[model samples]
Target: MSELLSIAQLSVSFGPVKAVRAIDLQIRRGEAVGIIGESGSGKSVTWLGALALLPGATISGSVMLNGQQILGASAKSLPGIRGKRIAMIVQDAQSALNPVLTVGRQVIEALQLHRGMDLWAAQAEARRLFDLVRIPSAGRRLASYPHELSGGQNQRVMIAMALAGRPDLLIADEPTTALDVTVQAQILDLLRDVQRETEMALVLISHDLGVIAEVCSRAYVMYAGRIVETGPVDQLFAAPRHPYTRSLLEALASLDGPLRRPNSILDGTAGAMVQQQGCAFASRCPNRAGVCSHLEPELSAGPDGWRVACLRADVAGPLEIVA
Candidate 1:
């Protein structure tokens, strides 16, 4: 599959504070990829900056969509591509949805804007989308306001609105946040099903590694505004390379294994708080050495695109294909 979106050397900063640094990411057509990290890891900022959606932020990088450069594209050309080619669904559906307007009206407006459908046709399409997202009473729900529906249903509506654009790529930022476990599972399953049905590229961003392992084929682990490790989900989950990745996996609760005492690896604050001239994670890293404090590790990669940024990569062994 060809790349639907490519980002290289992407950096973002607000004044003196650097939110993201030298990030590189790629999503192929119809692929489900994940960006996993804790809060303030620059996961959302990376994409938002890529689409030129961040105002007053200094963004320097190349953002290519379908082999065309879009980072610094003219304002006129950019708007047409945003919703039409790459739609985004944020975490809070309640915030994204307007309270005054009916859900159907919001969806219809998206259709009219992206698909240029008339009022009647847009309504029909909107209903079809509601059904596609498995919204109950699809026709009746159209007239319902945002507050009337459940959180999961409202998220489904958000998905419908995103799908209204018929985009080649969909960026879902923490789509399942603020939901019950059952509801979160439902929403994740829905995203997987929708991606399969639509054959659109999916970029799932979440703080939950379990969610990433559940839905994505590949994942990029972010820390201190940089991609610390990335690889096939199965491998990354089975044997994590970077210390941060290992700590993240260890933090998860296991059903079958005996109780393991929690470690203090994750106890420290986020890496962003420190002004490190070298490895940002060295301060809290378990395998930290004298060299780690003075030299930052460049992200090293194998031919399969499994990459890790750590000075002692040899301790982790090489990344290999599962099959």
Candidate 2:
């Protein structure tokens, strides 16, 4: 699997506040990679910088896609890559879709723009896309507005529009967040089947661990503005090295676990404060040591391509170190 996208030391800033700091990620062709973190962890910000969607935003570092430099490209050239080669499905379908436009018209517009199909041909392609997304009454639904459809149907329309461009990479931001459980499973299965057929790389961004585990081959856990842990989805979920990662899994596990308190809230304020010397997670970490307050730990490779940014990755069992 050749590398399709490589992001190294990427940083994004808004005014004096730094949202993402030196994040590194790599995605191979046809691979499914996930970025999981709590809200405001900078997972979405990093990808936004990569896509060049943030206006008045300053970005530094390298973003190489298929060996082509993308960090400093012109805005005019960005659309050529945005919808045509690298598509994104935002979290809110209602906000992303035009309310006035019919579902089929929206899909047809995109197809005509990128795939270069005429009006009649584009409509045919649109109908096929509707079927591909498993939407019933494909012909009748084409004339219906976005508001006329259910949440799941709107999401399917978003997926169909994204696929219209035939992108090499698809960035899905919380793709199933707004759907019901049954609908979520169906959407995930749809994505799985589509990926199998198209062989396109996927970048799934979400705060849901279960969602990541279900679809992604690999996962990266973000804290504050940096990657704190990364590994194969199953292995990382089984034995996470970072305390933050462990806490996330504990929060998601069955209610029988001792860590499954309904009101357990991991303190995240410390992550917002910059630590020039110590680990960023030290204040909230359950395994913090004296050295953790004064020394930052670099990400070190562990077994099976796993990387953890903790001073004591060798430790096992529940942590006692805390603020």
Candidate 3:
């Protein structure tokens, strides 16, 4: 699988606050990757900054898509690449879609804009996309406005609109955040099926470990705007190396065991933005040593291609927490 997207030393800052630190990531063709972290961890901001979607953000570093640099592309050049090459579905479907416009019109607009389909062809394709996303009464529902549709239905419509472009890469940012548990499962299943059928690369950004483990083969764990660990989802979940990763795993509720007390890491919130000379997670890390408070750890590759950015990774033990 050739690399479809590559981000190196990418950073995003708003004035004095750096929302996304220098982070590197890569995605290959037909890959399903997950970016997991708590809110403000820069999971969404990294991609948004890469796509030039963050207005007034000071973005630095390189974002390459199919060998083309997208970070500093011209306004005219970006539109051609945005929806056509890479499509993003945001968390809030209601706000993402125009309430007044019928779902069909919105989807048709995307098809006509990116796919270059005629009005008649666009309508046909829109219905097909709706059906693809498993929207009930696809044709009739297309005429209904976003406000008339249920939360899950609106999400499906959003997915359909994203698919209308036939994009090579799809970025789903907490796509199931507002949906109920049952609907969340449905959306995840739909996304997985669509990716498999289309062979399009997917980047699932969410805080839910179960959701990430269910769909993504590879996963990256971020902390305070930096990637702290990354590996195959199964391996990472089973034996997380970074202290933060282990803490996150421990926080997940398990069915087989008695409920365990949440770790202190969950209680501590991310600190305010300041120049950090050490590990960003040192403040909350249970395994933090004096070295961790002064020296930032560099991400180093370990066994089985697992990468971890922890000074104490060598001493880290297997996570006892089971999901």
Q: Top TM-score: which candidate number? A: 3
Off by over 4 Å in 3: 257-267, 321-323
**Residue 119, model 2: Cα distance from true site in angstroms:** 1.2
| lDDT by residue (tens digit), candidate 3, 33-98 | 999998999999998999999999999999999898998999989878898899999999999899
Which is the better candidate, 2 or 3, if ranked by lDDT?
A: 3
Q: What is the C-alpha lDDT of each candidate?
A: 0.89, 0.87, 0.91
lDDT of 2 by residue, 1-323 (tens): 99999999999988767788888889999999999998889988998898888999889999998999988898778777889889999999988899988989999999998999999999999999999999999999999999999999999999999999999999999989878999999999998889888999999999998889889999999988889999999988887889889878766646343444344467657476243668888888878889998887888988778999999777746523222
- Candidate 1 residue runs with Cα over 4 Å from true position: 258-261, 273-275, 317-323
TM-score of each: 0.95, 0.93, 0.97
Q: After superposition, how far is residue 242 of candidate 3 from its true place, in Å?
A: 0.4
Between which residue pairs do clashes occur in model 2? 286-321
Q: For model 3, how big is the CA root-mean-square deviation?
A: 1.6
Model 2 residue runs over 4 Å out of place are 255-264, 268-270, 273-276, 318-323
Residue-wise C-alpha lDDT for candidate 1, range 1-323, written one tens digit per residue: 88888899999998877889999989999999999988999999999999999999999989999889999889999868888899999989998999999999999999999889999999999999999999999999999999999999999999999999889999999999999999999999999999999999999999898899999999999999999999999988887889888878777765664533354247678886334688888878867889998898999986468899999767764322322
Candidate 3: Cα lDDT at 87: 95
